[model samples]
Target: MALGGNPIFNGKNFRGATQAPPVPQAYGQNQYGQNSYGQGGYGQTPVMDAPGWAAQQNMTQDQLQQMYNRPAAGPAETGRMTYDDVIVRTAACLGAVMAGAAVTLFVSMPLASMLMIVGALGGFVLALVNTFKKQPSPALILAYAGLEGLFLGGLTRILDGMFPGVGLQAVIGTLSVFAVTLLLFRSGKVRATPKAMRFFMIAMIGYAVFALVNMVMVWTGAVQSPFGLSTSIQIFGIPLGVFIGILAIGLAAFSLIMDFTSIEAGVRAGAPERFSWTAAFGLTVTLVWLYVEIIRLLSILRGEE
Candidate 1:
């Protein structure tokens, strides 16, 4: 599949995902005898008398030299997305998430539980909105991050209580996985090839089905174990969650690779600077998925121990 196969990148529409960056047009003549700058036509001499052109004609040697010495416009100045833009926006989103999480972390259990529910539902709705919206919205993206933080914080509190220190361990594990995946991508050791994407889609579908069924069973009180089938079902004395958790973490790691690939393509395609928020939002979504998977896996392992 192409780098833009992900729904999160549907707005970009990069042509071939390898098109060269657009070159700025010169002010000189063109095939039609028109000033390529759009100021005048071949039959018009008004462009020569234009104040801006006249000023250029009268420039001092030193002034011309200074103009030549000036640095070229960067991606931001050209109104195109850049890696720096994506980095800054992603940081902002993560900061909002941390702030939201802190709010739930210090609150009473009852209030935190309420906020967790609110956050889960709110985040889900906002995520869908952001994913399908043609244009990226910074405010909504940050709001989604904050809501996810609340859900994560509440979940961590509950899990940490049951498995002391598991929260910190999970955080470390998530960061480690992210760092390793990034390094692999940067080294060109991994990619989202068509074959890999096909496998990823299949696995994702199966995982989603399992998750949905597990959720329903939990709600209907169909399983006595805390994690429903994950704990109740075992293979050779190992809980089913262990295998499922590993698969989930692997999928989340691959998702980070997809995010990286898409963001790189977006930058290369010279997408609108505003789309940096979209890149940031995509990364935040993947990172959240990764963290949740890591934390859940840790909880399951702790439960087993």
Candidate 2:
């Protein structure tokens, strides 16, 4: 007896609680010249050989059709992240940043400064939010872009006010570095290997610590200059800040490489389509960092002169 009833009640098996029909086989041809077999005339037609369990089941046309039409069930689909997606998202972020900048330039400078501060704080918070979210949200990512835009705009205006044309120079510098890094990455000349990644992590930690210390010094009036000790110290008659800025820029560029690598891995691992937001967020972060570093370096150079 099967769990539910007798297994052989209807000439079927009651191996357990459920009963299963006997396997079918190709029967003799009918008047239509089609082979007929079991209750549904299933398995009457020869099918390609199936695996052991499937072969023993002798499936019906309806069953097979149902299986074919069913939604695929498995881990999320992933593939190599395409250049097109990255390019499109990056362009969108840049557009937002430019728009934010334009507002700061045309509007009150004080308001722009406030916005920049707000953006800096807001963007930092949201960056962490999006990074840890199990699933990426497009809205959050775009919001982050907007916030960072405000920050960049304010920063640019401040720097440009101090050093005429510095904004344009920084923009050009950022674009040049991005283009060069992208070309190198595409050409496989530079890669984010494990060793490089380890170094990046260590350098990033050190940089973050230094930035915090510098900011504290500025707030406490320990360093009277606009950029704290960065503007005061000199090496080879050049401001130490300039050298540090260059190194910082290099780190930002390498961070872009890591973002690219992660995107590639996500795509190849069949990550969900929505995860594209993560890629966009990462790129935005790197670009913002790059732009800030370039602008600061320009400011430091101008201050020296």
Candidate 3:
């Protein structure tokens, strides 16, 4: 998905799913007369439309009353997305990730490395497939999570082995950031405003460019440091990696905000229930990115120590 915003919410689907439905018109005095405001609509007379008193028509008095008093149908009944649906689907995806992560954690080092490569390659491919797909597929989304878990597990194992406790620290950091960001969003202390979004986009582009350059430098042996220019270069005596890592983490957190916004819009617009899978997938992707940045940052900082 487009990292700036959840890529899952893009194109026409994005436009439609996030749109607010038109407000329902209140039935007051109109060309249809005063009874239009009453039960059974404008078609019935005032006496007949009155609750409990409307006994004489095709419907029983109790039936009419029940119909009038029936609570409005929710997203479940209307075949739309809801907070509950998103939560359940997101949980399922994360569960798959954890299960897959456990598999790698218990494997031999060589086997884990192999699985990591496989997972990285497989996850990247599947991520593209799922993001561009018009309709959300439960199978693909879950597969992406599992594959990503494999990769994460392997990476974490390798890093934690070299530097004890870094992995745990990173996990704690990730959770802390997530919890804080979510709390801020819920409390309305943080929001994805247009100005913030514009900044995010510009910063993301610069970060992506830097990441690509570093990858190239590392691959080509231009820099021997683990993180290439990021570690080799320094600004004000602090490794450039530190600043970049913090910035990356910030961007990832803001990305989570965008995901939350999109999901909220989707629910408001009465998006299809199955799209909850889409929401889940988007959230999973963002969380993974956040975790990776956090762990890498921890490793870099610990290395300095």
Highest-scoring model, TM-score? 1
Model 2 regions more than 4 Å off: 1-81
Q: Arrange candidates by TM-score, highest first: which order?
A: 1, 3, 2
Best by lDDT: 1
RMSD (Cα, Å) for all candidates, in order, is 4.6, 14.9, 5.6
**Whole-model Cα lDDT of every candidate shown, in order:** 0.83, 0.70, 0.81
In candidate 1, how many clashes are counted?
1
- Write one digit per residue (lDDT tens) for candidate 3, span 99-213: 8788998889999999999988999999899888888899999999999999989989999998899888888888898889899989988988878878998899999999999
TM-score, each model? 0.88, 0.73, 0.85
Better of 1 and 2 by TM-score: 1
How far out, in Å, is residue 101 in model 1?
0.8
lDDT of 3 at 212: 97
State the lDDT of candidate 1 residue by residue for 148-245, as single tens digits. Answer: 99998988888889999988998899889999999999999999888888899999999999999999999999997879899899999999999999
Residues forming the 10-long window of minimal summed lDDT in candidate 2: 1-10
Q: What is the number of residue pairs that collide in model 3?
A: 2
Which stretches of model 1 miss by more than 4 angstroms? 1-4, 14-51
lDDT of 3: 0.81
